[model samples]
Target: MMNEQLLDSKFETEIFNSQIEMKSLFYNLETEIQSNISNLSDFAFESHTDLKQLIISTNVTLQDNLKALQTDIMQQLQQVTDQNLITQAIITDFKSDILNNLSAIATYMNNNQLSMKNNFSFTNSQITNLNTTMQTNFNQVIADVQNTNMNIKNNFTQTNQKIDTVNAQINAVVTNNQFQTQIDLLKQQIQNISVSVSISQSMTSDQYRCLMIAAWYGSYTARDNYFNSEQYLIYLTDSGCPLLKWW
Candidate 1:
C-alpha cells in the first residue's frame, strides 16, 4: 500500500514538474511579447514618422520577434516534453515492477490467510532480501530522477545567465523592468521542489514503512491520520488504484 502511494505521488510529481517547466517557459515568452509591445507603442508615439512607414516597421518588428520567440519557445518546450516522456516511461516500468511485487506479496498473504496469516511462511532472510532489493531499486530510481532534474536545472541556469547578459546589452534601449523578479521567483520554486523531493527520498525506507504501519493502526484517531506520515501517499493496489492510504 505504501509503495503504491509512493508511486502515485511520484507520478503526480513528474506531471506537476513538467507543467511548471512549461509555465516558466511561457512566462519568459510573455515577457518578451510585452517588451515588444511596449517598444512598438513607444515608437509610434514618439517618432515623427509617416503613418505608413511606422505601420510597416512595426509589422516587420512583430514578425521578427514572433519568429524568434517561437524558436526559443519551441526549444524549451521540446526539452520539457522530452523530459516528460522519459519520466512517463520510468513510471510505467516502475509500476510494472511494483505490481509484480504486490502480486507476489498478496499471493503469499492469501495462501496463509486462515492459519498464521500474518506469520505466513516467509523467512526473515527472504523478507530482508526483498527489502534490500526494493531499496536498491528505489535508490537507483531516485538517482536517475535527481540526475535528470539537475540537468534541467543546469540548463535553466545557463539559459537565464545568457538572458541576463542579453538583457544587460539592451537595457538602455528596452523599457521593460528586465523581468528579473519573475525569473528569480520561478527559480526559487524549482529549488524548493528539489529540496522537498530530496527530503522525501531520504525519508523512505523499510524502517519508515514499519513506522507508518505502527502509527497508522496503533490508535483509533491515528488510523486515518496519514497527514503526517510519509507512507500516506497515493499508490496502486491489486484491487484497483490509485489508492490513498495512510500506510
Candidate 2:
C-alpha cells in the first residue's frame, strides 16, 4: 500500500512536470515568433530568399522539439502503466493463493470433526456391547450354579434312601429265622444295586457312598451263603458293575 501510494505520487508529479515543460516550450516559441515577425518588417529591404529560409528553419526546429517532448512524456507514462499492471497481477495471485489456503483449512477441519464424531460413536457402541456380553455371561454362571446345587440335592436324597434300604435289609436278616428267606432277600437287593450301577456306567460321590455301605453290610450278611455270594459277584462283573470306573 505504501509503495503504491509513493508510485502514484511520483506519477502525478511526472505528469504535472511534463505539462509545465510543454507550456514553457509553447511560450518560448510564441515569443520567438513575435520577435522574428517584428524583425521581418525592419529587414524588408533585404532579400526575400533569406527571410523565407529563416521562417522555414524556425518552424522545423519547433516541430522537432514538440515531437521530442511528446515522446519523452509518452515513455514516462508507459513506465508508470507497466508498473501498475505488474502490481495488479501480483495482488491477484496473492488473493487466489490465500483463498485456496482458507478453503483447504476449512475442509480439513470439517473432516476431522466428522472423524471424531464417528470414533466417539464407535467407542460408545463397543462399551455398550461389552456391558451386554458381560451381563449375559454373569447370568449364565448363576444358572449353572443353580443347576449344580439342584443335582447335589437330588444325589444326597438318593444316597439317604439307599442307606435306609440297607438298614431295612439288615433288620430283616437278623429278625427272620428261615435261611432260604434271608438268602432270597439278599440276592434281590444285590441284583438291584448291580443293575443300577451298570445302567449309569459312571458313579457320583453319592452313588459311591451307597455302594460302599451296601458292600460292607452285604459282605457280612452273605457269609452264610458262599455259593450264592459267588454267583452275585460273577453277575455284577459280567454286567459292567465296576466300583472303580477307569474305562
Candidate 3:
C-alpha cells in the first residue's frame, strides 16, 4: 500500500511540473506575438508618413513646374505679338514709300510729255521758216540769173562790134605806112586797157552777185562808206575782199 501511495505522489508531482512548464512556454509565446504585432504597426505607420511626405513634395514640384510653364508661355506670346506689330509697321512704311515713288514717276512722265510737246512745236515752226527762206532765195537766184544772161548777151554784142572796128583799123593801118608807128602804139595801149577792164569787170560781177545773195540771206553787213566809195569799188575789183571782216 505504501509503495502505491509513493507512486501516486510522484506521478502527481510530475504532472504538476509539466503543467508549470507548459504555462511558462505559453506566456513566452504570447509575449513574443504581442511584440511582433507592435513592431509591425510602428513600421506601417512610419512608411505611411514617408509616403505622405513624398506625395506632398511631388505635388509642390508639379505646381512649380506648372507656374514656370505658364510664365514662359505668356512671355513667348508677348514676344510674338511685339514682332507682329513691328512687321506690320514695316509693311505699312514700305507701302507708303511705294505709293510716293509711283506718284513721283507719274509727275515726271507728265512733265516730260509737256516738254516734248513744246520742243516739237518749236522745231516745226523753225522748219517752216527755213523752208520759206529757202523758197525766197531760190526765186531771187532765178531772177538774178535771168538779168545776168541778158547782160552777158549785150556785152557779147558790144564785144563783136568793137572787134570789127579794131580789125578795120588794123587793115587801114597796114595800107598807110606813114601812120603805122602811131597805130601800133595805140593798139598796145588799147590791149592793155582791155585786159585790165576784163579782169576788173569779172571781179566786180562776182562780188556784186555775192553781195546780193548775202543781203537777201541777211548775212551781209555793209560798212559805213560801202555804197559809192572808190575804196568800195576797189575792194570789189580786188581778189582779197574782206567779206568776213564786214560780217
Q: State which candidate, 1 or 2, has the greater TM-score.
A: 1
Q: Write model 1 residue lDDT over 153-193, tens digit each, in one string.
A: 87677667756655564443233222223223333433433
Question: Backbone clash tally for model 2?
Answer: 0
Across 111-138, the per-residue lDDT of candidate 3 in tens digits comes to 6777657687764565466557656655
Per-model root-mean-square deviation over C-alphas: 40.8, 75.5, 72.6
Candidate 3's C-alpha lDDT?
0.50
Number of backbone clashes in candidate 3: 0
Q: Which candidate has the highest TM-score of all?
A: 3
**Candidate 2, lDDT over the whole model:** 0.52
Off by over 4 Å in 2: 1-48, 114-247
Please identify model 1 stretches exceeding 4 Å from their true place.
Answer: 1-73, 109-122, 172-247
Question: So what's the TM-score on candidate 3?
Answer: 0.45
Worst 10 residues of 2 by lDDT: 40-49
* Model 1 quality (TM-score): 0.37
Two-way lDDT contest, 1 vs 3, winner? 1
Error of 2 at 144 (Å): 87
lDDT of each: 0.52, 0.52, 0.50
